[model samples]
Target: MIRSASQGMREGRPLSSSQAPLNVVGEEAQSRPGSGQPAGTTQLLLLVSLAHLISHVYILALPPLFPFLRDRLQVGFVELGLALTVFNVVSAVAQAPIGFLVDRIGARRVLAAGLGLGGLALLSIGLVGTYPWLLFGAALTGLANAAFHPADYALLSAGIPKTQLGRAFSLHTFAGYLGTAIAPAVLIGLALLGGPGLALGVVGLAGVLLVGLILPMRVPAAQDGADARRRPAGSPTAAGGSIVTPAIVSLTVFFTLLSFSTGAIQNFSVAALVGGYGITLAQANAVLTAFLMLSAFGVLVGGFLADRTRRHGDVAAVAFALTALLTLLVAVADLGPVVLMAVMGAAGFLSGVIAPSRDMMVQAAAPPGGSGRVFGIVSTGFNIGGALGPLLFGWILDHEAPRWVFGAAVGFMVLTVVVALRDRWLAQRNSGAGTRGG
Candidate 1:
């Protein structure tokens, strides 16, 4: 039973009724039997991470097939582009609603269904080979894409031990990064073996096979549909608190700023280097590739730091601040090829270091049983930033101002730092308030 504030104070338990429920739930969550057996926890992480990887693979998979698609479908670039635009738009709009569904039904079932749906969409597109079918498949895949972050985070939070969550989160992110890095090569290789259809079919089949592997295995009790329904009324598990809290809203903004800053560099750095510095295309690409590879390695290192520290905001803020300085240096300084690669790679490393800390902050803000919707809401920021980033930076390039690409990225990073610090301050205040007696 949740005591009133006055009663709690008299009993020397100072938590408000609202706060007490979460504390109780947290204890229950941590103490649940079989929650952290190493083998089971590792299996859960592997499946979830692989699902995330496939989700990212699908995101970039189609672009490599564009040439084949254009030839086979006899479509113009505009139509093909519209398919991608539709994908992003649908994914962004559906994420929040899908998240709500995740909290209601259970992440495990939703995740399997999402993966199966996405695979079928890809396979159908490959088999059909028509423009309208392509559009439909793109939209369907977008909806499936919406489910990944919410479901993955929900499962990880409920299934993994609290002590090891940072590393799990980092590994999950690294898998997504790996997928993006490998997608073009893998898809193109498959295309070479047969055709575009073969490439899509193969990748799609992988998702379907993964679904089979996940369906029979047990998920955390907290994420089981029957278990959620059985929870006592008035508990945090039964009545999930508000999803649109100040902390969530702020985190959403922070995600958007973070996404925009990173997207600018990822989408435009090579072009910026080539045009602004009069560098060769090969050199520019080499620098960008180094940046990307180093970033992936940095994510692993950041996981250890995330596990060791409670000051996630400070870590994120410091990393973003350093990245901003590097961006500024790229914009204004003239450097040799070796020096450029080192600086840009260092910047990417810092950016990757922010990933685990970013997830930690989001987890900190989520109430028990609310991971799905909170992560869903915040992850929408990526789509928003992705949707807007091209227009902003492409315009800068079109206007013949490549240096501004780095400059704009730097500006967004600074904004990210401010938001990170603000979130940290808010968390500190809330923590202090919760500890004080009424």
Candidate 2:
């Protein structure tokens, strides 16, 4: 009976304590004063969002600096690309281990250290006299970058009230996108004013300062010693044990597919529009800008929907289905430029609307105490998709098959709907089983 209950809970059913079922570890972690409730919630959310912003800024800082590095250091484009590749590869490899550290020593310390490390590494890039040193610095930055998602999501999951989690996730994601949007302008402006080296040094110092600021703030741990002390002697921690599970693995794949679809559009949509749609570069850029801006706003709207509905899968399914339809229409239809822009904007809005609900699905699937590790493992999907999507879409563009780009994205969107529905079905089945047992 106990084994069956544990299995059921893992499948998404809620089990009573008497059932001796698997509990989401650390579900009660936020009950402590100044952790998840009213007094500390606002402060915690702000700090986490700031961290999210900073992480994205750092991720983008190097890219804008690429031209500068090539001109000043006389490095080839391949060498510069290698530097970015090293950063991403190192980050991808290190994220899971860092998540383990977050779970063990707490997110507060890890987050602070990551900020400091990334900042110092960026500073090193500014001061380095040789190309090898630049590569080394990039590797360090990647190592630092790996800490954000796992730590940020873990802390937010443990510290925010369940009722407000959707908004928190939306804000966090919005902050990241904001950071990405601003990085180019900020870096270029600083470079023009003070030289590239000086700009890099200043930005790096800012990161260090943020570390100092965050060090003093408390973030709730996924599992704390105090909470452990309060539990019955033999009772399991919520979602304790190994972080790897079938459900988590499925979510990981889901994220990878989602990223794959979006990454193509983000990286190549302007080029695709210019090449295939007979649009000027400026016009393409304008449409892309509208898409991104509307998407961000859509995330805010999605937050409200996430809070109002418990059917996260339904929300995701509907949104993605719409996105797929719009994207397919863009591929097949010979619409006017304005109509194309409107269709793309609508697609972006639908895609954005899925953001908060997608996050809620992950939260529901996460084992309480294991959030850090679980998120760490799952988020690698983004890295994988980021690494691969460009190659795939770039091939389509290189072959003059630009229309296929949107079509490919549509295919991925359809796959995402399938995954979302599968997850929803499992959750519903588990809920029904728990009801019957009760």
Candidate 3:
């Protein structure tokens, strides 16, 4: 049976033990973004996950669909890259505004509308023969993805039990990752048998169905809008009248850097494998799928530790360090597909673990009434990294062999590890001090 939150933690929000292996705070993490979720927290997590799944599959539509789209549009590298740049740019820029809307209007309204429109946009992509029209569809899809995170996370923090936050978030991220991961194989297969239009239509129809399902789900947004209205001034103190803070800028930086590394890999990994080692697209896609699966596992484990460990920052540091080392190994070593897959999977697992910890830390560090703002800011940074990752990798790919791109990715991983270590130390010291003062 699932356990109740430990002492000092509130209902629906369990925190890691103060002295647990990577403990930062026992219950403090859960309480940071105050939750008054109705009794149906599990159901709430499912709804949140489902909402994300619909939008994420749409965002990830590019990967497997790329081969088909390239053939149909007869696009060159320059054109393909430009379309991607626009898509990522629009999405990155939209995160902050979308989060602001979430803060103002509540997540349910924003997310529902975004998902429905995004679903339509996905269908439109299948029909749009013009490059500009395709780009327009991509922008709409990005907008839908942007709408999901802020409100979804706020709802999760409010509704899900703290101890399960990691698992919940793992499931949350996996929703997107899963859709993205499965997309290549499924879409490719569909294309082989049915053609791009049919494949795209099926994918779009799936999103529409999900949106229809969620429309009737009736998610209550108690933690976000209602709370903001009730405490218009916001919570000024912790339980004992101490200041409540949420980590904002620093978490954003970490998330952005991490995303940069991942995005670089996403954009260039196929080319690198095919050009550098002469691997087939199917093989390359397999490697990516393995990597994503490991990442999902990493997230689940990381979330579990987030609620169990006392020193979360250090744990994050360790996770990033592992990712860096794996990246370096992947870059310089002339390993076969098996070894390469193993290392890549392990790297994804370790690095991916940072998701829940990062989210939890940022929410906890926010000053009163700023959760939406901070979440938005961090999300924008993440999308920015996503936007830049491809462009940067593409530049390197244009100038140098695939090895150079791998080296650049290694550099990103190293930088992220250093930043994560710094974050860990700061979170521990500040949280520890907070405990003593309280």
Candidate 4:
């Protein structure tokens, strides 16, 4: 039996039911033990993770295809870069609105539409003969890309048990990273075997198939009416109130700085090592690969830690502080190649360790029933940082300051720690005030 929000509030617990018709039965079943409920939950997790994975694969597919596209279209690097810029810009600009839509309409509908449209757009790119057509296709993909975060997070928050939410988030993030990790190899191998056009068509077909798989699974809708009716008179989401609180805004900035730090390392570390440390390209790339692999492992570790602790902001603060110190060490140290690789790997691990905790903080701070919009608004920080990091770090490289890449990374990490600690303090203060009032 699915309990309404009013019932749950009277009972002093928020039940795991949603406003969407399809989700009520599924969520209720998942909340109880027996009848293979665990297996059902696992299936739900896999489905959500797959959605996350596909979104990232589409996001990354274009980068590998860029080389082939440039050759086929006879375009310069600048024009190719513009195509990427347009994609990210469109995604960033559209994400918050899509998030709002996710709250209003339904996450499942938006997510299914995004996958289908993105796949079709990628197929269009493969078929188009002109540069303008390529740009058009990329823009469509971006608009589609904007749907994933809001929809995915909202669904997970509604469907998954609170105890397992951290792990669910970890798995979702890992799938995204895996998608990005595989995209280069998958796209390039396909292009090599059967031309870029055929490669793109294959990937696009896969996305369309994914949409077919997802459509039958119903998603939960926002619980605004239930929450509004049950909430205290002066609460944030009551009486036509705003969901964008100070904690949320702070979290948004925190995400931006975190992305900025990671973006610097991901985009420039190899070039910086080659230019500044005189490491060979292969050696630098090897170090980078190790960092990435270990970082993924760290996310797994972080998930375990998140479930054991409620102080998510503290977890993020400590991880990022250590990450900053490690990154600074990388900037200043002139160690042997092996030692440098070890240090970089450690830094990567610390950064990854923050991921689950970072997400949990946002989950903690979100106004009740507003996960989609909050995540959507905060995630734009990623696009903002992603857009800005390349420009800033590229400038550093252009000025022949390769060592400054790590310097800049460390700077961003410090800023991230500050914001995270502040968020923690705010959460703590709010909790205390509530305690006293009670």
Best model per lDDT: 1
Count of clashes in candidate 4:
0
Q: In model 3, where do residues sit more than 4 Å from their true spots?
A: 1-38, 70-77, 192-194, 218-224, 232-246, 277-286, 367-370, 428-438
Q: lDDT order of candidates, best first? A: 1, 4, 2, 3
Between candidates 1 and 4, the lDDT winner: 1
TM-score of 2: 0.88
- Per residue, candidate 1 scores C-alpha lDDT tens digits across 9-43 of 35543231122221112233222365323235667
Task: Encode model 3's per-residue lDDT on 126-222: one tens digit a residue.
Answer: 7776667788887887777777787677656555655666678778887767767667677778778877777777777876776665555434333
List where candidate 1 sits over 4 angstroms from the true fold.
1-39, 226-232, 235-237, 434-437
Between prediction 3 and prediction 4, the one with superior lDDT is: 4
lDDT of each: 0.84, 0.79, 0.68, 0.80
Best model number under TM-score = 4
Off by over 4 Å in 2: 1-36, 221-240
**Mind sharing the TM-score for model 1?**
0.90
The parts of candidate 4 lying over 4 Å away from their true place are 1-6, 9-39, 221-239
Candidate 1, after superposition: displacement of residue 357 in Å? Answer: 0.9
**Candidate 2 lDDT, 110-212, residue by residue in tens:** 8888889998988888887469988899899999999998888777777676778898889988888888888888988898887778878887888899887
